[model samples]
Target: MNTTETARRTAVLQSALAKQGIEALVAYGSGPRESAGMLRYLTGYMPANTEAFLVVPAKGRPVVVSADKNRARAFKTRLGDEMKIVKTTDLTGALKEEVASAAPRGGLVAQAGEFDMTTALHAEFRAILEPYEVTDGYGIVTGQRLKRTAYEAEKHRQATAIADKLVAHAMSIAAIPGVTGPDIMAEVEYLGRRLGADQAGCWLAVGERPAETYFDLFELTEAVGPNARVQIGATVCLDGYYSQVLRIGMFAEPSDRMKEVSERLIAMQDAALARMVPGTPIHEIVDALETMIDAYCPYTRLSDPFRFQSTHAMSNSYSDPGAAPFLNAGRDKSRDAESPLVAEHQVYEVHPNFTLPDVGHVCAGDVAVVGGSGATWMSQYPRGIVRLA
Candidate 1:
């Protein structure tokens, strides 16, 4: 991300903290991948090894505390010059010193986020930052992130464009004889990088039991064969944003049932888009989508009766931990009702997938923004089954 984007995010976060009565956000990152969510949102620093923390006080300049001197040094050279950067073995002491001036009105909070920290680490973190009430208030910041700046919206468009191209490329080669699963994987990865992605990844299931393999996520043991339907999922990361898409690649003529199911999936997504109006409870939409799925789907997945999530929030860190609008809305009616309203500007990946008697896991998915009247597609491609041959 550019300096402007970081500055805008920092300013917005500061305002949000002030509103939530949160003194600061102690976003923790055990490694670079972990850093990609909250920590990187502020410091522009992805920790190489050891732990890193970005402390953002409501009324003060943010600071980055890192145990990794090497990565910290590199961050300074590349991006951390605006914020205070302290390389230290005493991470907690550094954090304490930074937040010392803030009044103890709002609680001090930390974000171990999606991957909650190990018990030992959590105890240590709680112990050293004593005398103040510490809480998991990451939700406050996540709620704020639901609204994206114009910069983020544009980046999201570009990111999804990469994945669209990837799916297209895979389809172009699907009918080629002698093409294997690895061939498509290799081509997609190479093409993704060539298209200027920070990272590109794919999950595929081809051959006879394609649905079963696709259900397994990374299944690619079987080769692409004639008359086989290929179930594929693709993700591409560019800048700090990521995009995802899923589609079925069929080498033979699709059955009438396949076309009908594909159309139903499209209508399902349309129903989902209508629910993305700002301030609507996400759980309401999720419940509605589940009803649609249950009503439309008649058969179990090839391997078993299990089914995957129908939808989720997506953007930074893929399904972002630092963003609200998650599908896992809390269970309690009181809490679940309050579980992340459908805020404007959040991106969600809606992929309703299920298996058929003859076809494997048929899927149609895309990334879209929740704004204006409802969700708008960031993914600009065909939404149904892609006939390759």
Candidate 2:
């Protein structure tokens, strides 16, 4: 990523702040891995698991504060002369003090979240600030990120291609009756690491029963056998950009029921994607998906086995983009889907699956983006289940 590109993004963010009458935007927290994301958006320094904050004041220099050790690393990384690295211990207070001293008359301050502010920190901000706004900067930042600049799109394309290679390797060596899920997971990790993946995590399941949701990085399971359904996928990070893949393998021959469900699932996915073109209301697409599900696989009788929702938003690590234009299940409603497409260049991984009451499970998913042409698939993975035996 070019430093000039990052500076342009930061300027856009500052413009957003200016509209809100906020003179400065401060981002700090231990939970957000994208702390570096915020800074890199301002200055091009990708900090790892370390304490850091970005001070985006309306006027003057925008400083990236970090510990002395981290400062050395940031400097070595070549974040440009614009960044001012400082100690991390009193980072929040230090940033607040700088804003206070510089503005002197107290100006508008914006934070990523209310939770990111401690009670004391909130009080201190109020004391030093005239007017303040609690905004989700992630949304503000995501709006800029969703539309991939030519440079960003190219990087993501590389990341997606790497993920495709890893998926292909895993598909080729899929386990049969005696191989465990962990055994397969090991292969995923090896392939990813060898292919320049920053880190890879996978969930492999094989059995007659549908695999339970496995969220951990590494967990072993027993062998997959005939008549069993095996599903595996991973979230891969490459050079700070992210992509994911979800695929299914079968050891047993497909039964009539399996074939029918798989066909319906693919049809549903195609229907969903067909409605994903620009200018089509997002809810309209979501409605069509649910209506098709109900028409094809009545939910009341098959609720447990079948679940489908809007495509998931992509970010550094599945970071929520607030209200971006994409259909998603509502936070409170399990069956409710709410989202709309905002613009072209927004990326998503559409993982739509179908589960039969007793016949096992089948699913298909891949990364795609809304564009002038239409919804485009990122990877050329097979849409239906492939028999391993």
Q: Give each model a TM-score.
A: 0.85, 0.81
What digit string (tens of lDDT, one per residue) describes model 2 on residues 1-389?
Answer: 56677667767777887787776777653324544454444554454555455677766666666555755465546655555655556655676666664343545566653344558866765564544444455566655555555555555566678777766766666654476666667888888878886666676555676746565535555555666677776667675566777777776677787777777767766777776687665555555565666676444324545454546655444533433233544333442344445346655666665455565555666777667857777766676776775
Off by over 4 Å in 1: 18-23, 31-36, 44-50, 77-80, 89-115, 213-219, 299-304, 321-326, 329-334
- Model 1 C-alpha lDDT per residue in residues 148-259, reported as the tens digit of each score: 6667777778989999999999888877887777778888889999998877878776755454543232345455678787777888878767788888777667788878
Model 2: residue 66 alpha-carbon error in angstroms: 2.9
Provide the clashing-pair count of each candidate structure: 0, 3
- Global lDDT of model 2: 0.61
CA shift of 109, model 1, Å: 6.1
Candidate 1 Cα deviation (angstroms), residue 223: 2.8
Instruction: Give the 10-residue window scoring lowest on summed lDDT in candidate 1.
Output: 209-218
